[model samples]
Target: MEFRILGPVQVYDECTGVLIVPSGAKQRALLGALVVKAGQVVPAERLVDELWGQCPPTNAANALQAHVARLRRLLPCGEPGSGRPHHEWLVTRPLGYALRLGDADTDAGRFRRLAAHGRELARDDPGAAAGVLRQALALWQGPALQGSGQGTICAAEAALLEENRLVALETLYDASLLAGHCHEVTGELEELVVAHPLRERFYELLMTALHRCGRQAEALGTYDRARRRLAHDLGIEPGPALRSRMESVLRRQDPAGAAEGAARAVAGPATGTGPVDEARTADDAVAGAVSVRMLGEELARLRGHVDRLTREHRELAGRLDRLTSSPVAGPRDLAS
Candidate 1:
């Protein structure tokens, strides 16, 4: 059995290969609220509030009980004819009701775990991180609880989940850049920036990608756009991370520096991961910093070499053009 709320509130039955989702909007809202905080008892009062807002009927509690009963019946159980009850997944607690689920039973839970694992692997192995992050992103079908109608609880949960999805996507783009696939991800990053103009991280990723592809001018232009948008919409400057990136691009520093920073940003000092792990994490950050500095130096040298070659090519072209235009000197000189 898998409970999925990443897109819509749904239950997939492995035994029967059927999807059990509540049909009524309010019922879906109630289910979404409970599933978002699965394993915790959602008080009947809270459910009533989510279903009817402040205008709940006098019999809201009774109405909620009816909805829960229907939802329980709708959940799929064991083998078709086994007469098993699906109510095992939903437990009645003294505080309220709780939805029981294993650690990996929910798509949202699995997505978080996968994303965490991907972030952990990013500093050491970018290719593997990209692959894992891809898997994590694949879990999102659409906006979380898309059809579920508005309730503050439901809306807030949806927003939080979507934000997580975007962060994971940005991390994936970072991994792709570190794996030397900036050209391939530029289009996706562009779309993300358009979709989320207020998101500084996406803009930062886009700028880094553009810079890596030798479009430093466009990359700098992206920073200008980000700055203008942030100032206009939020009446604020870009955050420290984004401002730092803009400075790096302006200085024509290593594009790989952005990737290292991304690694630290996503994987930084997660609480409860312990002292030994913290020390290891610090070591990794240092290693990533060193790698960024070395790569920046190499990129600077290469850019200089390319610039020289381009200048020489243009000078040679100018001389050739002058000689060619100089009055068919070939015939006159040959005759002499």
Candidate 2:
């Protein structure tokens, strides 16, 4: 049996071509809660709280039990004498219930595993990584846990799953760029930039793709748009990576001159040179010194960016801890 919760909550039996889906919204929510926290006993109180949320019925426990019974009957019962009973899939514990998946496959689990594998492949085999990541993304039929009741657990899990999907998308773009598919991904990256204006990484990738395709002017224009958006929305400037990419576009037109200048600056005074040569060497040394100072400033900015990212990461981790520890009130559009 393959339990699917990536989209609608349903259980499929490949052997018999049977699809068992809980018809009730609450039942789907109940099954979703169990599936997300599968292999562990979710306390009865938590389940009740998620179902009714501050307005639970007087006999909430019994009502919950009734719902569980209906869900169990709706699930598949394995084989007649296979020794694997349907009840084994949803077992009642002293405090609550557990979904013992046993050998059953889940699209969520497979998507995560495949995403990890694709990330690993991204370093050395980006083409292969793109393929694997596409496969992982193809598992999503719609919004995660769609049609499930608007419970805290399901809502939070759906949001987290959707965030994971976005991360996988960013990884896919990275792999696509590395595999020399810049032109192909440029359109999607542009759309992503518009959809997620705050995501500076998308802007960076789009700029890079445009620059690689000899659209230097457009690339610079994209950087300007990103800069203006960041400034207007976040009251901040672009980070080091985006700024560096923009600088690359600015210097794209005179690559030979830039390379030769850098070489001359690094080489210092030429040996046995004339007075004019010595003067030019001195100029080159001054340019080198200026370049070194500019690089130091850029490094300082990068360090600040790193520090900001670290603080943001810590804040997000703390928020996640709180979300997992307690129930969040309100419904979020996970599909968005």
- Assess every candidate by TM-score: 0.71, 0.72
Candidate 1 lDDT over 1-336, as tens digits, reads 787888878888776677887898987987888788788988888888888987998888788888888887786544456565434667788778877775328888899999999999888999999999999999988889877778877899899888889889988999999999999999999999999999999999999899889776678678779877986898666788986776676565433444545565566646766555555555455545644674575467558868989999999888777777777768554454
**lDDT tens digits, residues 1-336, model 2?**
888888999888776687888888889899999999999999999999878889999999999999999988877666587555544688999999999988788899999999999999999999999999999999998899999878888999999999999899999999999999999999999999999999988999899888787676688789879877886899788898998887766545433334555566567646666544555555455445544664676577668988999999999888667666766533452221
**10 residues in a row with least lDDT, candidate 1:** 253-262
Would you give me the overall lDDT of model 1?
0.80
Deviation from native of the Cα of residue 138 in model 2, angstroms:
0.7
Between which residue pairs do clashes occur in model 2?
A: none
Q: Which candidate number maximizes lDDT?
A: 2
